[model samples]
Target: MDVLLAAAAEVIALQNVAMIALGLVIGIVIGAIPGLNVPLAVAIALPITFKLAPIAGIAMLVGIYKGGTYGGSISAVLINVPGTPAAAATAMDGSQLTRQGHAGKALRMSLYASIIGELVSDIVLIMLAVPIARFALKFGPVENFALGVFSLTLIAVLSEGNMLKGLSAGVLGVFLSTFGLDPLTGDARLAFGSQELSAGWSFIALVIGIFAVSEALSMVERRGAGPIERSRVRLSDAAHRLSREDWRHAAPAIARAAPIGVFIGAVPGLGSAISAYLNYGIARALSRRPERFGKGAIEGVAAAEAGNNSVTASTFIPMLTLGIPGDVITAIMLGAFMVHGLVPGPQLFRDNAPFVAAFFVLMLVTTALHLVIGRIGLGLFIQAVRVPNQVLYPVVLALSFTGVYVATNNLFDVGVMLGFGVLGYAMNKFGFPVAPLLIGFILGPIVEVGLRQSLIIARGDLTVFVRHPISAVFLVLGVVALVWAGAREWRGGAARGASAR
Candidate 1:
């Protein structure tokens, strides 16, 4: 309570009006631009913020994290492009709304729903972090490994029509992760004797290749062949707000997605993409008119934005309390802490109570700022995509090249980017989902590390995984999911054969 009061005091001085307002603008712009992440913005600003007191620096980063996560939805909704994968779910229904002429209303509802989710998840993090962290502290390697497996299971159905390929991608990702020096053994695995290859692939480079450059190649292939651009007349100037019924229907969805987002985000290793997908699944599962989903359903955008933005802040809970960063981004934040000479752990919470609290306060402030920009600046975000694909495609390629350079300043990553882009475009062309590849890349390392650690602790006994109840439950669920997906695939094949006969 005292910590919050101090945070409020600091924020009140941010009553500076200019800094907060400028931060908001910077955040939105950074987020709307494809290939730029919250970390990029935060890293760029960190040196500038260093001049300020600790509270202000922390507050600005927190604000960027929150505002940037929401800002991506604006771009995703108006264009078929997702500024961030977290915004991919928003794109699902939001892009559809563009075709239906309710783009403005969809954007408005997404902004509002995002604000609601951010506020609710902030409350959950502030109030519930202790208990959750306490439980997480009890988690052994086996439990953690099983949890990682569970995360992979969520992507089983998400792989879409090519589960074997998904498995292949996942296994390859895990194998690639082994190229680095092993944590326990202090020895390299697949470095092939090159000092540079010892680091394997940089995370930023991989994301750029898969999300940005790959998107560029796919767009290039479809250049002048996409669905007609009749959507330019979307949302006449007079119709700029969500209908009462829209908000009425969206409220329940926002509520349902919030807990799911919070829980998923608070747990280490499960990021917002899975949370958004899960929320969309839940909203569709519970809807009276399930067929409305993916056909410009307002609920889809609302639930997705809610889950995505809320999880951005929610991931901090485990990070701050248990010293376990929930996602790679949060893990970077942990590194940011060490760079600032601040040790990351529960003790830091004690030493920097007010500063830590300021981080929490800024999330709410950023949400409010996002609402203002979303309502007013949304049109610009939408309009910016008016550039022709031929012109924009090069820009994406350039940015993809730049992002790759930023990681290692190496041309090898650029080559890798082009290769992955072609591979990604091939998969997309054949109607395969990209979600599994991403999930696999993100979770594979964790699963490998966890499984290795658990096995080492148990002297090579795989049975040790089931000794813990939580691990056993998750393993059981993973087994059940694999069985179900396999059975469904067999049935689908049989049905297709019968129909052909």
Candidate 2:
């Protein structure tokens, strides 16, 4: 009771509340801009937090994290360019909705889903952080390998009609990921004698290229073809508001994705990008009309936003309970904790119960603030789509290159971005799905590291994956999903052939 009272007193401070709001605004602006991601925002803000009180500093960072995660969906819906890597999944549907004149609806859904997901995950962190952290600790290399394989099977789902093209793109992504130095050996595998190649490709550069730059190229091509009618969001339009029916469709997806995000966040290394894609795949799989997924399904936006936003709060679970950073963002937050002389672990919780309680309160308060701010900004956010294509594309192009150089301080990365921009444009031209390639790239490292470690531990015995119950389950599920997807593709092909005959 004393702890609760103290926590309330700490969180109710005006400085803490103001700091949270400031961080959130900064986060949203950065996140909505193409090529500027959430981690960069956090990194930039880390220095400012050094001078504030511990609770106030940490609260501001938390606000940024939550806001940035949601902010990515804004540009994704408006421009078909994800502001963050995780928002790439949201772009699959949200972008389509923009083209279809439902940008307002998609934006609103993303906002609501983000708030709900963040709220649920924060509650979970407060209530079940320790237990969930303990459960996450059980995921060994073998289990992770199995999980990666299961995640890879999602490529088939994304591929659907173009199974061959999807698989090829996925394979290309895996091959690209292998170009970096070997994770275990530190020996360069595919550097091709270039010193710069030793570090492999920059993920940020690749993402900005494949999504933002490529979209700019497409916009240019569209301009050459002739004038195109762009979607405009009018305030009085019914499509701009979320109706009961839209909520009915999106609520189930949000409910399902929030927990998935929480679990993924509790486990170290599996970040928001993975959770976003996985939730999107799951939502499409369970939807009554799966065909609507890539064509502006409200549930798709909901799932992707919810899945990524939920990760924001749950990520703190491992850091707070086990002193383990869930991902790069939390790793930075861990530094903030240590800087404040608040070591996060079992001891810290016991020694500073009041502070811990206050932190949780602050998180909840941040979520409420996120909702209010997001709602107020919805009108302004949707206006991005109202810009002329010529102006918007050039600005986006300049920002894409500038952001990449600023983030990496390397000219080589800018070149890499341009190169991949061409690759992405060509892929789109050829009717290939880019999402699978991205999935493969993101999961390939995790799969490779886990497989190598498992093999080393088991003396090259592949059966070790099946020997562990958890790993075995994941493997079986992967195989089942692959086979099901193949069967569906085959049936669709056969039906097409029959109709042609």
**Which structure among the candidates has the greatest lDDT?**
2
lDDT of each: 0.70, 0.88
lDDT string, candidate 1, 1-501, tens digits:
887887766676744234556766777777766557776787787776666655566666666777777877776676555666677667767867865656777778788888888888888877887886676555667887897787677565544245677566656555655676776677887777877667776555655565566666766666784332435634455455687888777889999998878877877766776677667755754565545766788998999889887787778888888778877667766766765666657887889776678766766666666677666776665554455666656765676677566556788767766776776677667755555566566667768778999999999998998988999998997888677666755766688789999
What lDDT tens digits, residue by residue, belong to model 2 across residues 174-229?
Answer: 88888868999999889998887788888878888998888778878867532123
Q: Which portions of model 2 miss their true places by more than 4 Å?
A: 224-232
Looking at model 2, which ten-residue stretch has the lowest summed lDDT?
224-233
Residue pairs in candidate 1 whose N, alpha carbon or C atoms collide under 3 angstroms: none
Model 1 misplaced stretches (Cα beyond 4 Å) = 1-10, 13-17, 73-113, 159-197, 225-257, 268-304, 318-360, 487-501
Residue 73, candidate 2: alpha-carbon lDDT = 88
